[model samples]
Every structure is written in C-alpha cells, then in structure tokens.
Target: MTEPASARRITGAGIVLVFVYGVMALAATGRSFVQIVREFDDAPLAYGLSAAAAVVYILATLALMFSRSRAWYRIAWIAVIFELVGVLVVGTLSIVLPELFQHPTVWSLYGSGYVWIPLVLPFCGIWWLRTHRPAAVPELAAAAR
Candidate 1:
C-alpha cells in the first residue's frame, strides 16, 4: 500500500535530517564518554556540558525518527530548540568566561571543535520540523473543535 502524503513528507528529506542527527548523537556520545572518563576533574563543567549535549542529540534524533506521531513531533521541536539555546549559552560562556570551561566541548566556541555544525544543525532541524509537520489526525481535529 502507498503511504499518505504526510507520512512521505515526514520520512522524505526527514531521512537526511534523521541521518545527521544520528551521526551527531553518536559523535557527541563518544566525545563525552572519553572526556568524562578520562578527565572529569580537568574540567567538570565542560565535560558535563558535553554529556548533556550528547543526551540532547540522542533525544533529538529519536524524536525526529519517530516524528510521524504528533507527540514526537512536538518533542522534536523542544529538543531542537533546546539544543540551539544550549549551543548559544555554552558557546558564549566558554568565550566570555573561559575559566569556567577549562576544556572545550562539542558546543564550545560556537562548535569550533566540530566545525560549527552544532551551531548550524539546530537551525536546519527547526526548518525541517516546520516544513514537514505531520497532518493532524481527523479525530484529534474534530475533538479539538
């Protein structure tokens, strides 16, 4: 059977988005694991932030992958927006108060460590979520009316 228009949209370019998020999740997880295990004392704040970034990436990837559901779509929005905010806050803090973050994280220096992909990915995610939102189910729409 053929998929509906909404499903196709959700799984179309979204596939690429999912792929990128998946890669980010893996990279962040690996980086954070090494940093935290190797030298938590060297820069607890920076390594902790890296671990948090990994969790956010993992959540975003899962939310996007399961975005066919309305709840998951909203979760995707939350995750992506949170990621953008995190990158901005962490990036600024790392620069303005370098002492606080003795070590660089995935989001440090505006993601300079990762070629700024961390800074740019959230914008792309937000755009994709807005463009490919799943259509409301008729039952839900009727209930809301």
Candidate 2:
C-alpha cells in the first residue's frame, strides 16, 4: 500500500530520531571507551553505565530505522522511557551519591555535559512514535479496503 503523506512525514521524524540517537550512541561509546581504557578503576560503575547507555541508544536507533512493526514501537517506547528514567535517576544519584559516580555519565547532572539534549531527545522520540502509530496501523486496513 502506498503510504500517505502524513505517514511519510512521521517516518521522516523517525529517521531524524535515528540520526540523533546514532550520534548519541557514538558520543557515549567514545566517551565510555576512553574512560574504561584510561581509568576504569576511577569509577567503574559510572563508566559502565555510560557504556550501557550507548548500547541502548544504538539498539533504539536501529529499531527505529529498520522496523516499524509493533515490536519496534514497543521497543522504542520502552527504550525512551528507560532513557528518561535513567537520566533522572542517574542525575539525582550523581549528586545524592557522589561516591558511586566519581566521573560523569551521559545522564549525570541531567545530561549537563551534553546540554541536556540526552534528556530531551527521548521525549521527542516517544512523541514521534506515538504520532506515527496510527499511520502504520491504518495503512494495512486501508489496503484491505
């Protein structure tokens, strides 16, 4: 079935999200690698968390790019939600539990090092996915008709 212009536009948003998350994945991976190799003993937990965040970002980006199935939608939702919670929790804990995080993370200080883009991107992704959902489902029904 031919996709409506609206669906195309929404998919474009998802593509944009893929780019954004891909960049984030690169940044987080690079930073984590540097920290892990240069100073693993300094703050294993925080650096490890940074690596984990990078993996999640990569997975979410790929899922958004390659699949528009319900599974991908669910994955995107879960990933974005987890990312939001991760940032908030890690941001707060970094202050409240400074010893556990001797160094920074993508989420540390509410993503302060990254201008809080890390904190905001997930909300955008979720919104885009929600907006695009109807286009995906209805296209199938419209095809049958």
Candidate 3:
C-alpha cells in the first residue's frame, strides 16, 4: 500500500521547504540576538522589529515542521501570513520613512538584507501548505455528521 497522505505531504518538496524554513529561523534568530545584545540602543525600533521577525521565523519553522497535525497546519498558516504582512509593512515603511529605520531589519526593504528570501518564503510556504494539506479523516467526518 502507498504511504498515507500525511506522510506523503512531508516528502520531496515538503522536505525542502522545511529545510529552508529551518535555515531562515536560525539565521533570523542569530541576527536578532546580535542586534538586540550589541546595538539595540542605536535603533531600538529596527532591532525590535528584527527580534519580532526572528520570533515569527521560529514559529513558522516549528509549525511547518509539524504541519501533519491540523493544529500545526493552522499555526503554520498564521505564522507565514503574519511574516508576509510584517515584511510588506516594514519594507514599505522603511522606504517611505527612512528615518524610522536607521538600521536594517530582516524585513526592511522587502528583505533586501536577506536577498529577498524573507519576502518570498511566505508565498512559497502558503503554496506548499495549501497543496500539502492533510486529507480529512473519515472518523472526523463521521463524528461531525
């Protein structure tokens, strides 16, 4: 017999997505930590935004990694969507009000500091999650009925 839908969902491209998210999580965490520890005084808002981005990245990574679960799938969507909004808002603000961002954030300039991965990753994640969503269980359906 073939693997279950949940198992198949996390193979191949799914694995790649998870790996990329994991890397992004680590990178964001490290960058934010350094900024907060060393120079938060110089640009509190920018550094705080970086820290918030790092938290979002970490949440997304964990949620994606465990997305076989329905709850985790929901969390993944929330985290990824939040990340996208954060990127767009911060990127636009950084450009329109440059003085507000004396320092670059992970999301500043549409993730220019990270070569735009932060901007693009969420779209990819949404696509991946949509395509890989777990098939509804008959038990749940029957219970609901």
Instruction: At residue 39, give the lDDT of candidate 3.
Output: 92
Models 1 onward score TM values of: 0.92, 0.83, 0.92
Better of 1 and 2 by TM-score: 1
Residue by residue across 67-102, what tens digits does model 1's lDDT show?
878999999999999999999999999899989877
lDDT of candidate model 3 versus the reference = 0.91
lDDT of 2 by residue, 33-110 (tens): 998999989888999999988988888787676556777778877888888888889999988998877789988988
The global C-alpha lDDT for each of the candidates, from Candidate 1 onward, is 0.91, 0.83, 0.91
Model 3 Cα lDDT, one tens digit per residue, 1-145? 9878756658887788888888888888899899999999999999999889989988998998888789999999999999999999999999999999989999999999899999999999999998888668789989998
